[model samples]
Structure formats: structure tokens, C-alpha cells
Target: MFKIMIVEDDHKIREIMLENIKKWGFDGLYIEDFNEVFNVFLKYEPHLVLMDINLPSFDGFHWCNKIRALSKVPIVFISSRDTNMDIIMAMNMGGDDFVQKPFSIEVLMAKVNAILRRTYSYSNVETDVIEHDGAVLNLKDSNLIYNEKKLELTKNEFKIIYLLMKNSGKVVSRDKIMRSLWEDESFVDDNTLTVNINRLRKKLAGIGLSEFIETKKGQGYIII
Candidate 1:
């Protein structure tokens, strides 16, 4: 089932959207903290978004742009403002579609299903898999597989392995590794980097791949 994240702040509208979304066989999530919308979005990784123009902190356009940076997931703007400028700005802000407020739930469902079909039907094949030794990292699902054992990885861990495995035998710089993490991890100190790397290594070790990620001391890490 496709997951639909609703970023609408109106309590009644959000509740109705959630109920109708579930009834139509989709997983619906309503954002509680407007300021943490992007964080919640990264965690949920929804297939599509229903966004509102006026929100508590950042408007829907701001959040849509942030999501666009991290993902190509479809974002459909649902707003009361029906001006041509609003529609144009929504599209420019990476909105897949715009639904004016006071829409029928059935029409919304139809649009959601249509976008899903268009996006996934012809392009459901998984991409971005990197392999080093016998270990394979699936960037799509953020998981690692080695010797037929599958290990789930957090977003940070996946980015680390992706960078290392993409450059396989080369030493990826610590600074580069830190920069690769999705959000504000660039400001994190060295010890935090060490902790994340160690945790990732331990997870790999648990799956019997102890020497998968090699450290280059004062330099960085390499996958060989």
C-alpha cells in the first residue's frame, strides 16, 4: 500500500483526509510538528504528500522544496488559495499537482492513484545498488546484503556505505563522509562520525563481514 503524508494543519481537514485515505487502501500520516516536517518525511519516506499553503512555521512551498532536495517523491499541494500565481509557484516549488481546497475525497483519491500509476507503473525497477566484495548495498531500501544475509541500515549508515562502496578501493575522506549525511550532520564533530562508522561496522560484523569497511587512520574509510 502506498503511504500518503498529509501536511495540512487544519485539524478537521486532516482528520477527514486520513480517514478517507485509509478507506481507499492507503497509509495516511498527518504531520504534528510543522517545524519537524522534513525530519518526519525522511523517516516515513511516503510515496506522496498532501500539503497546505498556510502552515504553522514554514509554508508548504518551503517544505516542498526541502523534500525535493532529498527525494523525487510526488508532492501535491492542497490549498485554499486558488490564484494562478499560487498554482505556478507550487509547480515551480516541485509540486506534482495542485488540488484546490473543498475537494471531494473521491477526486483526491483518483488523483493520488493516477500519479502513483504514472510514476511507478513504468519504472518500478530498483536502482542505486553498490557492491564491494560480497556485500551489496541497496540505496533504495537502505539495506545491506552479504552472503545471503540481509541487514537493515539507518539513513546515515546507508549514505556512508554508499559513498565508500561507490569509490570501492579509494579512501573516502572523513569530511566527505560527514557531508554526505542528509541533513545538518555536517556540523557534527569527529567523535560523532566515529560513532556512526563504528555502529555501521558492528552491524556489518554481526552479519559476518567484519573487515568490510577499513579505516585509514587519520585519513578516512575505504571499502575493499
Candidate 2:
């Protein structure tokens, strides 16, 4: 069974989360030590994490960053802060989704199932959907689609797209992309980065997303 980790402080809410998670048939664990949240994370190696924004010492974003450092396990924020900034912050902090306070149990479970299905299914499921106007990057099959056209992407192409798409309009430095793609390598030349960007752009154009990638001169690139 898939394992889920919950990092909520409130006892009643924690119990509710545990019960709901168990009802979905997935094994779940609650963080007992607020200080060593990451320890429970490592011990469980959960497929997903449910984090609350408010904690004893650290906020959910800090925990999310720590977990991201260790694993790419999907993290979803369950918080009472329903502001737009909160949601955006959650996404920017590596959270896959957000559940506001006073949310329906059924809806919460549905979201959990949706995340689990898209994340861990046996089929060629996508890592996520990167939306840019009419264009969408299919993370699973490494396909870029727009106006009914489909462009297949290579491993590097997919990685670049994933990173840029995650950031969207934000300028993603070439170094950032390189770090994600060639982590073990200390150096990746400018030509390599340019080539990857060119290839990705061409593939996107084939799918009618031409001019979708914006160059920022000395900065980097973005899907605007």
C-alpha cells in the first residue's frame, strides 16, 4: 500500500486526516515530533506528504524544502490560509496541491486519490500538466501539445520543459536547468544549454506554441 505522512499539529484534525487517509486504503503516519518532522518523513518514506502551514518551529514551506532536498515525494499543503498568496506560495514551495481549512472530507479524499492516481499509477501517467495559454506539456509521455499538434521531447527536452513549465513566466536560468539535468556534472557548456533550449523550442513550435519560449538575453528562458 502507498504510505502517506501527515504533519498537522492539531490532534482532532490529525485524527481526522489519519482516519480519512486510512479510509482510502493507504497506510498513513502522523508526525509526533514537531522538531524532527523530517525524521518521520525518512522513516516512512511516504509516497506523499500533507503539511500544515503553521507548525511549532518551522512553517510548512521549510518542511517542504527539506523534503524536496531528500526526495521528490509530492507534498500537498493543508492550511487555513486560503489567500491567493498562500496558494501561490504553496506551489512555489514544491507543493503539488493545496487544501484549505473547513474543507469537505469527501473532497479532501478525492484530491488525495487524484494525486495518488496521477503520481503513482502503473500507466504512463504524467508528472504534471504545465499549462501555458493553449499549450500543455504532458509530463508522462514527454509531449508538448497545442492546437491539436503534438511534439515529442527527448530526455533533456523533457527535463528543460518540466523545470521551465514549473516556473512558467519566471526566468529560469540556464544554470538552474543544467543543475536539474546534469547534477553529477560540475560543468555544462553554454552550447549544450542553447542546444537543449533550441530543441525544446522547435518541438514546441511543431505543436503550435511558437514564440512561446521567451529569451531574456543575459538572464534565461521562460514560457510566456
Which candidate number maximizes TM-score?
A: 2
What are the clashing pairs of model 1? none
TM-score for each model: 0.54, 0.55
lDDT of 1 by residue, 1-224 (tens): 78999999999999999998887677989999999999999999999999999999889999999999879999999999989999999999999988888775655665676677768783553334555554666666888777668899988888888888879889999988888874565567779889999999999999998898898988889887
Candidate 2, superposed: residue stretches over 4 Å from native = 122-224
Best lDDT goes to which candidate? 1
lDDT of 1 at 216: 94
**Residue 61 CA error for candidate 1 (Å)?**
0.5
